[model samples]
Target: MANPTACLLIIGNEVLSGRTRDANLQFLATRLGELGIPLREVRVIPDVEATIVATVNEVRAKYDHVFTTGGIGPTHDDITSECVAKAFGVPWVVHEETRALMAEDYARRDPPVEMNAARMRMATLPLGAVPIRCAMTSAPGFTMGNVHVMAGVPRIMQSMFEALAPSLTGGVPVVSRAVHAIGVFEGNIAEALEAIQKRHPDLDIGSYPFYRPTPGSTGFPGGGVALVSKGVSLAEVEEATAEITAMLAAMGATPIQGEPG
Candidate 1:
């Protein structure tokens, strides 16, 4: 059977404004791949309620699983939880268990912090949502239907995902093989690469050019093209990689196994 597909929604104004770079997409993509859920689409939107609600509704119907990160904090702009609730047409309510947990933790603070309205906001979730708890914080992310909401902080997000991963269903994990053609420009092998891709239509064949500056030689920065073949079947990936290796050798370039250095 084909692996389940997933979509990631990164919600934050800081990300769009370039004030904070998004660090969750790559991590989620890689981890989802390992769990046999291919991350097929990603959308980065500001903390606009309409946009977040519309995007959440759109992608949740399109993909088997949906992950959202950001805007679940105490600040005013942190509105992803409410937006998601709106998307699901569920009333946003406070989760008592999470609120109780947070209250307990806050009581143990050095200064005995109070669970103010802002801090209590983190415990609020969509009606009927299941809390996704992590060790990093008392406040929890939640799972509402197929959508898994997580914190935007990389460390906290990763912990939430780790806690939630075991419950997820998966299929055969996708695999990849790569060969770097040293000293070969992409133009030198574009036609051959296209031919290879045509021959293996089931696999994803890609050529990426990179520059690796030689220690002392200032000659064109010394780079090459990397040919990667990705698929669910290891045999198919190996077969396509072998063809790529042969193509590079035919062009008089040494094909180095794996990624470019």
Candidate 2:
């Protein structure tokens, strides 16, 4: 069977404004790849209610799984839960079990933390949603239909994903093989790479160029191209990688086994 497909919806004004860099996409993409769920698309939207509701409704229907990060905290700007509820056309209410759990955990604090209205907001979720518990914080993420909501913080988001990973259905895990051609430009190998890609239409073939400064040198920087082949079939990836290596060798460039240092 084909692998399950996923889309990551990153919701935060900080990310779009470049004030805070997004670290969740890479982590989620890698984890999903390991589980055989390919991350097909990623969209970074601001913390707007209408946008979040619209995006949630859109991606949830398009992909097998949709993950959203950010705006789930207790602060006033945290409105993803209600927006999701609006998107699903469900009532937004305080989830009783999650509320009780958070209350108990907070009561055990050294100072006996209070469940204020703001803090209680963290326990709110859409009707018929399942709370996702994480090791990092008392506040929980939640899953509604195909949409899995998670924290914006990298540590908390990773914890939530790990907690939720077991429940996800997957398919054949994708693998990759790379060949680095030393001192070779992508323009020199683009045609060959395209031909190889055409021959293996099921695999993803890509060529990336890199350059590094030589210490204490005024001359031009040294660089090379890294050709990568990815697919569910290990044998196909290996074959494509070998073809790329041979192509680089035929062009009189030294082909290394992996990415350039």
Candidate 3:
């Protein structure tokens, strides 16, 4: 099956300045993987209109799907919608549906909904775009020309992504299983692990090492290693997991069945 290609654009000065660590990339990456979509590239840009527009246009032209996170909040710095509109060469205006949603949400507050101009700005959208609503936030997202505009807030972005999953074109789901090795560092078994990965070119094999209190020791987490394999077929993951597990055991190490909780 053909893999559905996607590119991610993270727009925020907070993330770039190290003020906030991005959570959307990992969330979207795993979620897309589950839906059989492989993320091809990711870019992080400051909340600048010119840069956002350029990156949006670039990714939309290159990938089957382009997902953007951040810069959609109800603040002056938020400009993703306008930038997207400009990139698509479409008119930008206050979207009535989004305004209604925002108004209704604001009405639920202790005080009556204040129709402030800044809050109203959150309702603007690009011309000929579809509204992407979410329960997490009232600011609606938009989809135009394969570009999906989502919220800067991680929760709202995730909700929008979930709602839009049905519209995405994806390939076979990627399935994976992990094998754990106790008392063995990653380097000791790196050669065998690399061999298994080489033998299965179609499968993606990864080795992750963790140091924690020892498993058998009380209050002290165990430090161990994990081998994970992902592919289009469950059988492929299972086969790779089995082979790698056997290899680790033969090297005088204990291969645990699953990754530690």
On TM-score, the leading prediction is 2
Task: Please report the TM-score between candidate 1 and the true structure.
Answer: 0.96
Ranking by TM-score: 2, 1, 3
* Model 3, residue 45: C-alpha shift (Å): 1.2
The Cα error of candidate 2 at residue 198, in Å, is: 1.2
How far in Å is the alpha carbon of 40 misplaced in model 3?
A: 2.5
Q: What does candidate 2's lDDT look like per residue over 217-254, in tens digits? A: 76335777778899999999999998988888888888
Clashing pairs in 2: none
lDDT of each: 0.92, 0.92, 0.87
Q: Which has the better lDDT: candidate 1, or candidate 3?
A: 1
- Candidate 1 vs candidate 2: the TM-score winner is 2
lDDT of 1 by residue, 1-261 (tens): 788999999998899999998999999999999899999999999999999999999999999999999999998999999998899999999999999999999999999988999998999999999999999999999999999999999999999999999999988888999898778888879998999999999999988888888898875457888799998889999999999999888878889998655
Give per-model TM-scores: 0.96, 0.97, 0.90
lDDT of 3 at 125: 85
- Evaluation by lDDT, superior candidate among 1 and 2: 1
Residue by residue across 1-261, what tens digits does model 3's lDDT show? 478789999999999999999999999999999888889899999999899989998899999899999887778899998899999999988888778878888898887779699887778889899988777777788798899989878888899999888888788888889888767887788888899999899999998887787556764246777789989989878999999978987887778887676
Q: Which of the numbered candidates is closest to the native, going by highest lDDT?
A: 1
Off by over 4 Å in 3: 104-109, 213-222
